[model samples]
Target: MPELIAPEAHRHAAWLQAHREWGPGAHEDGFGLLHDDEVDSPDGFAAWVARLRSSSGPDRCTYRWIIEGEQVLGGIALRHSYSELVREAGHIGYGIRPSARRRGVATWALGRMLDEARAAGLARVLIVCAAENAASARTIECQGGVLEEIRATEFGPARRYWIDLDTR
Candidate 1:
C-alpha cells in the first residue's frame, strides 16, 4: 500500500528549508495564495510549527507528504467540525513540489486523510478550492465530492463540495 506518514516535527526546519515553491515569502510569486505576506521569516516558520503542534489549531494536523522515503509534498488540515471555516479558508490544503505535480501524490494523500477522518467518526467532509483550480476540484470530485455551494469571499470566490463518507 502507498504510505502517507505524518511528518516528523524534527524535520519541519529542514523541510521548510528545502522547499522554495511553497516556502516563506512564496505567495509573492503566486505559488501560495493562502499564505499571508508576513510569514516570510524563520520566525514565521517557527510560529507555524508551534501552531501545528497546538491541539486547538486547525493547522495542528498539518503534515508533510512523503513518497518512497522522500518528502515531496505539504498538507495542512482541520478537523471535520471546522468545516465552515475550512470550506472558506482551509478544508484540505496540499502542495506537491514543482517536480512532483501531476503524479497522483495529492490525490493519494487526500484519500489517506479522508480515511483518517472517517475513522475519527466524521460522517461527511467539505472540501473547497479556488473555482478556477481545475486540478484541485478534480481531486476532490474523484474522491466522491459533490458540489454543494459556492461562496464569494474577500480572497476570492470558493467552490464548496461535499463528500458523504457514511454513504460510501
Candidate 2:
C-alpha cells in the first residue's frame, strides 16, 4: 500500500530523479519549491525542507512523500493553516512521479490527504485546480468535491471545489 511519509534526507535521490523527469521548472508543479540550483546534495535538500518547516510563511506546511516502500511515487503537502496565498493556492498540493502517472496515484494520495485534513480539525477543505486539468477535476469529484466557482487568478482560470469531511 502507498503511504505518505515525512520528508527525509534519504529519499533525495528518488526525489531528484523525479524532478529530472519533469525537467527544470516543470517540477515546480508542486514538487518541492526548493530550487534545484540550491540543492546539490541530499543534505542540502534536507536543510531546505527544514527551513520550510520552520518558516512562518504562507507556504509553511508538512510535505510528505507518497511512497510504496523505498520508491518515491510522488508527494503531497498538508498545510497547517490557510494563509492569503493558501486560500488561493489551497490547503494541499500534490505532484506525481512521471512513472506513476495515470494509475490512480493522485486519487489515492488525495484520499489519504483528506484523512490528514480531517485529523487536523478541518471540517471541510478547499481544493483548486487549473480549469484545463480534466484529470484533477475528475479526482476531486471522485473524492466528493463540490464545485464552488471558477475564479481568475494570476496563475490563470481556476476551479475551486469544497469537500465536506463531516458528511463524506
Candidate 3:
C-alpha cells in the first residue's frame, strides 16, 4: 500500500527517479519544490528537504511523499493557512508520477490530506486545477468537492472546488 511519508534525504535516489519521470521542470507540485531549488546534488537535496521540514507559521505547508516501500509514487501538500497565494493556488496540491497515473493514488492521498486539514481545524479547503485537467477534477469530485467557479489566474483558467470538511 502507498503511504505518505515526510521528505527524507535517504530517499534521494528514489525521489530522483520519480522526478525524472516528470521530465525537466518545476512542475512537481506536491513536493514543495521551488523554481530555484537545486535538488540534483546530495547537499542541495538535503538543504531542500530541510527547508520543507522547517516550514511553519500561519502560511506553513505540510508536504508528504506517496511511497510504497522504497519507490516514490507521487506527492501531496496540505497548506495549513490561508494567504493570497493560497487563494489562487488552493490549500492542497498534488501530482502523481506519470507511470503511476490511472490508479487511486491521488484520490487516496487527497483523502489523507483532508484528514490533515480537519486536524488543523480548517472547515473547508480550496482545490484548484487547470480547467482542462479532467483527471484532477474527477479526483476532487470523488472526494465530495463542489465546484465554486472557473476563474482566470496567472497560470491560466482553473477550476476551483471546495470540500467541506464538516460534511466529510
Candidate 4:
C-alpha cells in the first residue's frame, strides 16, 4: 500500500528516481517545487526539504509524498489558506509519476489531503486541473467535486472545482 510521508533527505535517491521519471521541469506540482529550487545536489535537496518541512503556518502549504515501500510514487499538497495564487492553482495540487498513473494513487492522495484540509478548518477547497485532463476531472468528481467553470490561466484553460467538506 502507498502511504503519505513528509519530504525527507533520506529519500533523496528514491525521490530523484521519481523526479527523473517526470522528466525536466517545474511541473511536479505537489512537491512544491519552484523553478529556482535546486534539488539535484545533496545540500540543495536537503535545503529544499527543510523549506517544505518549515511550511506549517496557516498561509503556507503542507506537502506529502506517496511511497510504497522504498519507491516514491508521487506527491500531494494541501495549501492551508486561500490566496490569489490558490484561486488559479487551487488549495490542493498533486501529480502522480507516469508509472503510477491509473492506479488510484491520486484519488487516494486527494482523499487524504481532504482530511488534512478539514482538520485545518477549511469548509471547502478549490481544485483546478487542465481543461483537458479528463482523468483528474473524474477523480475529483468521485470525491464530490462540483464544477464551477472553465477559466483561462497563465498556464492554460483550467476546469475549476469546489469540493464541499461538509458533504464529504
lDDT of 4: 0.93
Please identify model 2 stretches exceeding 4 Å from their true place: 35-37, 52-60
**Number of colliding residue pairs in each model:** 0, 0, 0, 0
By lDDT, the better pick of 1 and 2 is 2
5-73 in candidate 1: lDDT tens per residue?
544445545455446665454432111323552334666655655554454544334443454444535
**Of candidates 3 and 1, the better by lDDT:** 3
Candidate 4 displacement at residue 110 in angstroms: 0.4
Order of candidate numbers by TM-score, starting with the best: 3, 4, 2, 1
RMSD of each: 4.3, 2.2, 0.7, 0.9
Q: After superposition, how far is residue 35 of candidate 1 from its true place, in Å?
A: 6.8
lDDT of each: 0.61, 0.78, 0.95, 0.93
Off by over 4 Å in 4: none
109-142, model 2: which lDDT tens digit per residue?
Answer: 9998899889878888888888998898998899
Give residue 2's error in model 3 in angstroms. Answer: 0.3
Candidates 1 and 3 compared by TM-score, better number = 3
What is the full ranking by lDDT, best candidate first? 3, 4, 2, 1
Error of 3 at 108 (Å): 0.4
Clashing pairs in 4: none
TM-score of each: 0.73, 0.89, 0.98, 0.97
